[model samples]
Target: MLTKRLVTALLTAVTCTITTAAAVPAQAAASTAIPVPSTGEHLMPAGGVFEAGTAWKLDVRNAPLHANSAGMVKTVADQTAALYGGVAAFNAYQYSTSFYTVPADQPRVDVQWDNCQGKNYTPPGLLGPEGQFTQVPIPADAVPAKGTDSQLTVYSPSTDQLWEFWVTKKTADGSWSACWGGRIDGVSQSDGFFLDGFGASASGLSLAGGTIGIEDVRSGVIDHALALHMSAPGTWQEFSYPAQRSDGFDTSVNRVPEGTRLRLDPSVDVDALKMHPIAKMVAKAAQKYGFIVTDKAGCTAVVAESPQAEIAATGVDPWKQLMGSTPSYSIMKNFPWGQLQALPRDYAKRTVAPATPSTDPGTSPTAPTAVSTRYVSDTTFRTVRNGWGPVEKDRSNGESAAGDGRGLKIAGVSYAKGLGVHASSEVIVPVEGAKTFSAQVGVDGEVGTNGSVVFQVWNGATKLADSGTLRGGQAAKTLTADVTGASEIRLVVTDSGNGSAKDHADWANAKLLTPVATTTTAPTITAPTTTAPTAVSTRYVSDTTFRTVRNGWGPVEKDRSNGESAAGDGRGLKIAGVSYAKGLGVHASSEVIVPVEGAKTFSAQVGVDGEVGTNGSVVFQVWNGATKLADSGTLRGGQAAKTLTADVTGASEIRLVVTDSGNGRTADHADWADAKLLG
Candidate 1:
């Protein structure tokens, strides 16, 4: 989340159409450049604009491999010394394998690892012998009809190499294959090894719709790379093709915590959807068609009727119940559905149809027969046992039995007659021997007015405590009154002395005092703490530079106007007439640090306002003397915060500025803001 002031500032500064992108380099790949547009004569590299459906592939099968079974060991022994020396003798060959899917409906790509078999002592755990692989599949009934990609990068760690892959497209015969190739090889094989490489445009294959696969294919390469190294156990990671596909639990290594799930409030947050199109689609679908659980086998099971039959009995189209036309359901891996479980049949008068005998003979005749014998029962109740009741009931008119013996005012501005002030008048069951009262309060209005609603808990006639008014309608709060062994409880609402304005308060869900029986202590309450870095002194002059930086008013600085200096700094700065330049250079040698602790990221804003420029951008960087720490992003005139959130450790100096090294612009607007850290 961003701070209120920071959000406002960014929103104001970056009002023009802005675009962004991100890319990470691979150690074994060739240099890659963003393609720029061609002017009337000169051709320029693209800045950050990538065509929406552009595709690419990454091949992992062409890399190293091990075996899934042990029988292949003898085959390598026959020619172990012919290729290298004793190195290939005991090589399990299976230790360097990738996982691939053989689905029932699709042809699987055949991979050959010998293409990547090293001719020298490349040494396992040092560099990789992985290469790009592709083959058309032959249609055969014995082959699985379908296949999915698998994650093969997991083996790279054991092999002491960095590996990555992407599925690009299928051949006419349906064999899936990768399109890019790169490897970081020739290093000491050890744990925690790290390397960096760049994937050229050819290596930018997108994994958007592909799976990573691993297989055993090392017999031909066992003795090729070394003389005495032995193989180790090989493991492969799994990649689900459809982004929404889930197999029981995610196990993807990138899975979100089990307890925390993504939730978007549609009414107040529509922009979040734009960032995660797939998740937004799922959310919208969940809201439209009440969610159906996916089985352990990854199959979505349609819900014939809601577990809460009473709600289903309302004749509400489950699909139409969605806030919009989107469907929603809880995504659970271990959901239990042996027999249907529904709560007591309670109605909202208009919420559901009145209980009527099921015309179908199979509909239980015995259940209704038992209900006719009593208006209420003492034993535990189930949904089928209780019939739908009236929505309106006679509730105590602000009567109270508190120690003070005073009646509290219960009526107030409500959204509807049956709601709000009259919520208590609706049917409410007294929890036998309950000492507290609970109610669900919700608001739908701007933060200010929504935050002003006052909530209170009362015992009969006396006001025991004020639960505090709800200020925002976005979040829901459960208010409870503490009073042991009480027979009844009341909820009180006040408008804060304001008149006639109903902010759409919905009190449809309310219940009388009921305490959860527990001998254990109640959940502890704690407040979250926020931290900020302290301010630093010793400001340097001309310590900032960039391609450019701008604000809402216009360009703050264009090019490196401060001229040459021992260091990069810009304390007192002004803009130049140039629209874009090579880069912003600082005059002061010293660096300025921005505090960003307990924050997920840091972002910098640069460029001029109102005017568009070609190759115009602002990049935030952290440096340790001459060593660069991080490069945040290329800025656009009036662009939002593009944060640098990767791990930042042992960084001493930080700077913010802009540059247009790749392409030049003619607009005379640009400037920059110190990087802002966000949690």
Candidate 2:
């Protein structure tokens, strides 16, 4: 609607803005400088108000415009009226005017509404309650008025409520300015107008619903659909719904978005296009309810709502008597915005496709194996715009299971949501030229202290590999990259530090490792010498020697419930039943090669697995880098298993520290089964 609403208010973090401007003098505002509410107060909330509209009939309940089209709506309105030339460029007649009832001294000021909902909007900025958004006895100098992308409906039948406004200045610098409007209780509003679904304009929908407002030209007969307006907008998102392009389309894509409906050609013949009984009753409501391209002005227009709605419905002012009332703005000054017509918009009913995975997180055998040559699932990736489907698993908002688990999680990264907001996902590989793309990411639980989750890898736009920050559930970094043939590969996922709060994130077992060619021309014979890269040593477990561990949130790998090993780590192992924060949670850490003082003897097995002192256990310690040496004695949750020994004497580097046995972090998945240090 304006190139897709500043990219849908920066990916739904909505903010709008609009502040200063002037110019709205079209007469009205001298009833002795307006003013009448001496503490009467009741614009809305008496029953919510409604009624006061007059003279307007034809609306046989909707959906019925007979006469088949053999002319595909004037051949797409002559191919969009050949872009601004023919049909006199559909000029003038723009109005979003309103006033079901106004006279007690018109004006009514005192605004302030802005409901911004991006990442659910927070920090002292709701601006709703207080006076329900004033607007009572207005006129105060009629307010440095002006207009540009304007709208000012105003229903209030005592409270049936409907007061709409955008760029509605002079209502007395009240509050919720431009990116600030709303009140809507129900004048039907075609279903969505505010309450977040949006539509005070900028095409997220609703311009007095299907618009032609002035009670549809003294109810002459133009049932639904008729909101035309355009300075440019030829086509690229013919708008619908209360409008929704949060971002996209600027000097190009040629209009046709906002809530497009289009019509005309119920067999053409409107008295041979003689038009003008209000342009053939708005071309028979565009041959039965159709025209809706909503906005983008400066030239082609069709909005209206003033004339005090024909002096509050027929108190005379026959619109100065000729053939008009809401002052017909000179009855269609040559109407025909190029015969218009662009209907048939199925765009998958409204986008959201790529999400195939039935079993392939690349065969998830506890995850992590498919380094490519063929693997799939970046949720089956698909973005070059097709309506981003998969990566949306919202998890209500309390996220975990590594931030929204399964399907491409994107609830504002683990928490606070939206500062450096990011969430990518793609995959179209099979290039076969030069490859190497690995994955094992993490982040949806404890990174807390501040938060961090960066894990990039692009090929289309270049950026090769990143794993940089990472936290929640800690320990997970295998990211790799080297592409050459590149077919599309991507991943992105961000919130790098602090901002996106809890930073929920994960990508365990991700894969795409390809590079295996072989073929020598003219008679076999290969082997130029190569082989030297395999150093996999450093395995350690606890929870009593080796009850086998690895349960990421649920059923991770095996052994965890004997009432959560009821407090035991004494040589037989099995303690941590969830209490992980920094690095290892379901306990397990190692990096030995000691032998400094007495050669090595670190011993393990500790305790604390649930209630004894409530939920606290930290009998596990032994470091080298931030030096701690040895310590294991702090068990309560049921208690059992205890054997702590240390003798590296000089120590070189053999880390392991789980802490938080109580007081703060808990779900305690801490246990170090069979953790070694024998050297």
Candidate 3:
């Protein structure tokens, strides 16, 4: 639904630069720097991409609404309902923009101008009659936004320059070209707009401006206004202040002009709305910084930083965990649309008062420091398992027994205190109220660049950190996890798909931070004891209904093997060639809670079901509330089932849990064969 002028502008060169202006002082500094995978790659700087006074960075929670705010809200609401089934949505994975930051030392290559669409247009400044090109430092793996737009942005913090391209692509000869694009210099000092009518957006605004980044969502607070695309905008010549031009076509009196800012009613109780966590985040931002009409689209949509590039680089999709089961199109379904208050045209031109400086010293608080530290090697473990001999303290795990190992060494660095264990090992420690756990982990140098392993930390069902596939002699990775309020901590090591030969892994300089205990005297009274229950006839779990069930992949099947995702899709529950007619079939990362009615014992034979052959690996555990009663260490497919028995006396509910063995849950069909309760 974009106008003809906007579509045609993509076929020519567009160069933009910032106008000199007084810079605003930054309000606050970022506490922690975001970790970069490579040395030269950079993300948005501490405060943000541009100066503090830019329209996108201004705090407008108390801004006044226009006289015609109600009419504008009705226009947008009607169009939204017609286009998006009654609600505006965020374009997260597709039809959005992505950006990359590179260092000055990166290779500079010329991006040629392509007239691929056969449109008549003259090349702008910087691209002369000789077809000269400006060199850009783009990373090799950099990818543009997916879909038709193919928009890509590259920024250099060291140079304070930004380049954006539309319909961008790499040609067959490995050279880059775009139908149209622009470059901006002195980005940090700019007013968050393009000059000389050059930019990727139809309104001459920066593509990166107002776009929501992943970190903003993860932190549950967005500090800037959001960029919005609407189907109908005012006439092409009628635009607001931060926009140099507009591509609007609608001449209806109700059409909102380009650059018009609209916000949800500040009086609305956003938290009280039945909205998803992601929607609540957007709603709060809508009430605070509001939404700026930026471009034209088929439906009302908000811009989000495309997640494809990050997913490709890290092999992890953060949205999957952040949004959970909510689909992108419905993330904003519950947002309050009728209450939007449109600001007056040219809202950014209004004079605003500066923030008052704090006078009280107690207003700002520093980050808390560790109260006390204790070496994990000195702590007694509730459970410990090693692939080789015994777990060693203050040493590298030698192939034989305890105290037979050498000094704890990783990547040539020696440590005086730590725990050393082989792969396929687990060590559980009770750290009920610890602050944090930290360690320098790697495949120990004692292995001499031969073995590979992974280190992980878990607090119950939630995994805190993972060091993916560290090889011998590699630089040790610093692993730190927040364990506050966790009853127990699990430190696990697993072979990196290879056999566990020579996989000597070390948790060098491992320690826990905790508040020092305070002692007080108190009187106590003894209580009477009751008789233990006698064993009676067993009741098969398959014959009883579970109080609750949660699975990572498929639904929990009763008395059948976990085959696929559909209900009743599995065969008989089998492990190690033995079939069981009475049991429950489930996927890894599963939990089934059953009411025991004061049962004395819960027993099961747990293993990866034979239906998956040797493709799956898992660990089985039994829990009564937060207390773990039994655990079957890592079991793989084709392995004999391990018999598990737990004392469930006086317990009303018993939890059967299965988790992937330190790896991801893939083909992890697990069986609890002959599971029963006896009293």
Candidate 4:
């Protein structure tokens, strides 16, 4: 679905920001200038089939459509003579097309699209990653509501899916009237989505947002050149793209047939020309990586990047000054059309074929096996099962809602939580066997409330919690309930006073955390409470004796003995970072087995390495399998030694475990010096 240049976005790297633009070029000689090849993953020139930045495709679209001093093709002149009898047809009217934009504040929609049956040719395969689209919405303000021009582009970070629409018409019922479309997998370099040797209007790989974007202009530099279009000289029905012939069009002769490639003769120096700055940019691009034919448009015209994004990228308005009166069109009208040459119809450059990778075009990225907890969005009711109403539009007061897992935010009142104002929604708890229910509540929307709102959690008739009389200004109170054994949970919000008055509430970042269950079976045998008769005050064991501790540090670490072997105090055991029982992020653990008899207490000193900003912490605890006996609070990377002791009245197996306070193994270097089991 992601057609690079077909719809929106600029022609620059996806993440580059704007900087002072460079001046017009007197670039090094063509042979000396840094070559910017089109064959790389930067999808451009419609016929290309690469992903963003990997270097996969090298077909007719990216490779020099036809080698200049190397390859040959059926010249545009030869074909024109066989059809319209020559230059008359070439000089026939041709004009560039303009794109309109929708303001950024419009509501985005999950497009409902259908094929323009019988009108546009249907290829054997589908376009784009093969997934049944449900939440597939158009990118914010993807198209101008009134712009009759149908080409469109859409991307959903939530699903990592991008869609391209062509010859489109949006019906009032929220369905698409499209002549044709294609979809591509964003991650996989090559996918099952089909491609025709004869490229379509949006045939260029970079139709959707790719390397070159309007953002590049804002940065004052066009990293790449533009992709333009031309007509096949004759009405010849033999189409080069997915579909060569369609209903209502005359099939007469072959002219600038679909998929034809053209480039400015390398001999013509763009740097030597004196046209508008914009026109010069376009010409130089043609000389190097020329544009390919995508669609039949208002003559031999080149479409620029998304107009909306072009303006927004700058955060200023230089559109008119940069584009000029006719958007550089008047200037291009005089470009060297005669110097252009076309690439062969079906071109491929491979001497030895390699085994192609297997692909599954129809599957959604394997959905993470549903864990116990889930964040049920306030929009869709599919997961709620009961008590959700149609989405409402309330912009003014609701707390601005955060985008979903995908970085997408809609306009209007975002935090207006409810099924049509004072409404309710129910979601199954995260942990199926969880013994607790937890969530955050806030009257976050615009606070037009002298009126109040009540948040209640219920499992059938048994009420768990009631956040009473909450107003917008006093929101974000946390609520907890022991909802043990309940099959499902329901969260209800009711108006405390008069019918709901601007009670846009919020349920933010709620999670149902479940710890790994450990074996609680008491030990069969017990060790002495204190060291054997000759305990000799104390004999210590390194944490490495009981369990595997951190091998070293950093992912690249390999030498285990390199780190501090003992704590700074030099009395007890030393180990790597601390981590939870299972693992937090990195793997870290410390434990020791020692014979003891009536050992009264266990104490030690712990902290991360003495580095500032190391982001490490440790939790030293004495445990008996799943049960925790003593904790050393939380020690930071460089906090002063804090003494901790746990009474081991009738304990046999005394084990120590250091857990990472936050992320695993960043600054986790712990020591249990000055530690012993006092008898």
Candidate 5:
């Protein structure tokens, strides 16, 4: 129950702009001073006449309330409540037109009876034929009443169908008001009271149905009605109408204000919900809305991550969770969503390229005074090491081929002369400030005896950290260093003191990797080291030539069905299918890379124009040669985009390969765009 003052305050808050506020009071004063309408000569039509400045009030209520929760209070009394459950709002309706003429001597007023019960009440009732009117005899002693509910006798002067209404006195001023009462069961509504509000028209009404229509007396406009079918609970729906109907009571004119968030049902599926225009927008930004799962205890809901609490509180997915009646974000008019940036990568170094490569003599592979193809024995080489391995050599290469010509090779200079290791010996290569380092090294021939290897981080010429021994020969050895900030690092083979007769020392894949950097700035693509890429035959693929190409910049790599070669400069490779391939889509461990400075996030945009296959994705990843920098998972043309970020230390090769997940579906035709590395 609300008091008049409370209702007034609520109304003021809800409707701030109403013109002519004091007009109602002033008009009421003037209307109270006028004579009653009993003596008027002309009578207006039943549904369309106005009793100026007069006000009518009605109270409607519904019965019975059951408390669903333990502490909730009961409000509704029993079935005795006036309104069955109907909400208060006036409605006026037109029945039939008729006229009433009052005689001068009787000092009477003409009151027309318009059957407000719509078409249901036939001619026998007040909705009778023409020449009939409901004329109410006013008491001479009544004090110029502006509102009265006295029964009236009406007379109609026309032959057309006549209507009836309990017409009241006219206010001195022009405005008029009317109210109606109807009961509805099971519906909930406020205890409504109306001092001044008019009713209007309706639709889907017929004389055969039990629908009633009420109209504004002054304007003869049908204002409101009671639809008997809506008397049952849950049978009626609330609707807002904005325009003036025949009854003149058009109530739904206000627009929804800003900061209004409508919550929709949570059970909706994404694809199905997209059919609705609003739902589609929310799905597009699902990532921006994260969900935090928790139990009643306010703990991390995960079993092992944190201790399980009795009451875990977590954030629900805002986009999926409905807050009120609609699924919409309550964004302020000035809020900025378009200005935020997306981040994808996790590394900082640029690309993956070897520190130096085997090249033609007269070429400055290291300190190039000129360019030339130079051949030197393996004895004069230094090995580049992987900063990550346990060396995992037993898996691929046998013990004999382990550490064989597989480590990093620094071209041009002879390690034999630079660091002074005996031909049959090994020494430590030092890298300073390196917390840890890993590398793969190879011994060209056999190391029958004195097979020894040393790895260390160095400051220029001093060894800061070292790995004491390495089993030699074609085997690969992994080395890690914990020292930090070393200006120079080397992996040296001291004395092959065992003298196993291993001749040359060769190194291939080397990684000088560092931890992921923390920065917000996005990385930019550098101008390529080579001229604009030109299509070339496979025979010319050299370390120098390959180093110049940008990752994700080459031609599309279509799946093998097109007979496209994967061995060339990596031009024209398109993915025929995409699914869960072993290294990328299939397994979480697989990675891809993009050539850019610093750590960057990588996304694979798989384009599928309705094609199908199991090998439909192109994995855009960066790697320090054999070591992966970063990798993203399977992306279908249907899915279109997926992103993963990794850290890169220096120049690295980014490889996109499509491996079939073996789903055996006609692989989807997938195209890939260059990877976008976000910050």
Candidate 6:
């Protein structure tokens, strides 16, 4: 019987294999630019690793083979069968390399030398003139490759530098350390080797140069040479040109040397083989750029970027989606190992022509549309899961099927557009390039102050914003999140610690703000002017029912502070211990439109109400027909009120608005104290 540890290892290995072969989005393959999940940056330039004419990037189909090509191929096949139970396979998650790309702004930290492996070679100096250990821009969430080797690689396109580490691990002090590693400068211009004889691999080859990238497989094309690890390599210390050093221990004379390129026979038709899609892709690449013996490992295998780190950073598993039901171990089982030919050491060194540079910028070719506002009610969601009735659009969640719901209302306030869902519900929306997602959320009034639920927004596994527990009939809370670079957005509603009873939730006026390209144009400046009131007449805004109101939470209140749940349950408007007898009380994201009635000015003292203490933050603005106005920057509860005065001369109407200060509207009860108009 297999031990528990062994069974777990086997299961993990199988899972890694399946994930490694999974497919990527079709758009990812069509676009040469592949995003790094860790930093949302492009993996590398369009050419895919190494300089144009470098050996790793060379097309070796027509290259000459060694005189003992047949003998070398047989040796490799025999060694592979002996080590891997008669078939070669791809090393995916375990004993594999994982690479990451960081942007210019990534934080830099020093990597200490742990010397855990006790290797003999001297570690290379840092990118700067510093000693062996130096600062590298490794993401805080960076994960080393699985297995004992723990190989990790990082590239910074902004600096054109590459860093590789072995036995990488985090220290007790929350810093990083590695057993051995090397740094390469001018990576785009140098040969694909660690010149200082220091690297994660025994052969001193740059992992970034030959490792198969996810995009390469997604595109169905491997343009560069693939990295091959052999359990038996020629001579303990002997290596070929392009390989600066070697740790090969096999002394057999017929063993393949490190850096020896091997290619699939060009005469064979790879497309006709009974092979997995991933295997076919590997074969095509082998027939083109071939494979370079770069390292010695437990088994003879090809190396691809481990999907573990990418999956950790992003909840989506690209490999599982890419390979479907194809088992990873069987990917290369049908490969034509017998027909492989070993090329001469350092073959085509001076003959292979340099590849032409790509004109692409390594980004999506199609430009996104201009930035615009879109409502969630107008868009189709990917999936919807609800605890009770089906998710309803533009209405409150009722007990049964679609269209059985009523109007969406919270705290006696109605919404023209929104999503109605029951507790323990999830609505997933695909928003690849959206800039921001915003929504007003609360328990639907249909629950009538009964249910308690929490609203949350998520981008993959990362939670963007969350609303605290809210009861039915309470003023709605506003949620806004920066969703740039996210592939999808999840709107989730869950019961607040209790059992799901009447937990009908409403996401009112939910919308997305997407970015678009803008052309440069000359700026237009207008002169500022002030209009004086011709007559003195004042009227309080709270006394008028003729005004139109839109509140984030509950209904706009008269002469009081916005309270929790039900309407007409508010207290007197007060801020920082100061009380106002007459004022308009509203929630954050509230808007009030009143007829100007020849009023030349509008004045109000705005602040987050003291009733909720310091729990709320909001910004107050007064608009005069889209003209000159006054704005009270960001105000928090328990703070002094900010006095606002706006010139409304020649304006048909004036608008008073309160918005959450970039934070979720948890307790955003705002007051327009002493709000009045003068003519």
Candidate 1, backbone clash total: 101
Runs in model 6 with CA error above 4 Å?
A: 1-47, 119-128, 349-679
**lDDT tens digits by residue: candidate 4, 1-679:** 1122211123111111122332322221112221221111111112122221121211123343333312222434333233211211111011112122221332444444454332121222232234222333443333421123445554332233445555556577655445444454442223212232111233333343222232233223332334443333223222232222211122432244443445566678765665545455556655544544444422334554434432333333333444434322233433455666554443221111121121212111211111134333422323352222322222222222422111111111122222222334344343355554444454543343333567777787888877655555332344555566776667666767556655554443233433222223676866678874444244333321233344333211111111223111111122323211111111234444443465666655444433222345777777755678778777775466566677766776676667766566544655554455566
Per-residue error for 222 in candidate 5, Å, reads 88
Clash count, one per candidate: 101, 79, 1, 67, 187, 14
| Reference-based lDDT, each prediction | 0.24, 0.39, 0.69, 0.38, 0.24, 0.69
Question: What lDDT is reached at residue 557 by model 5?
Answer: 24
Candidate 3 wrong stretches, greater than 4 Å: 1-48, 126-133, 350-679
Higher-lDDT candidate of 1 and 3: 3
N/CA/C clash count, model 4:
67
Task: Give lDDT: candidate 6, residue 609.
Answer: 81
Give the per-residue lDDT of model 1 (tens digit) for 290-329: 1111112111121111111112223322222221221111
TM-score of each: 0.19, 0.22, 0.47, 0.35, 0.19, 0.47
Q: Distance from true position, residue 90, model 3, in Å? A: 1.4
Name the weakest run of 10 consecutive residues (lDDT summed) in model 4: 87-96
| Shift of residue 652 alpha carbon in model 6, Å | 99
Candidate 5, 255-295: lDDT as tens digits = 11110111112233444431222223222222222111100
Residues 229-281, model 3: lDDT tens digits: 87777655456656655667687767787788889898999878877666777
Kindly provide the TM-score of model 1 when superposed on the true structure, using C-alpha atoms.
Answer: 0.19
Worst 10 residues of 3 by lDDT: 10-19
- For every candidate in turn, the CA RMSD to the true structure comes to 32.0, 28.8, 32.3, 28.6, 42.0, 28.9
Q: Which has the higher lDDT value, candidate number 4 or candidate number 5?
A: 4
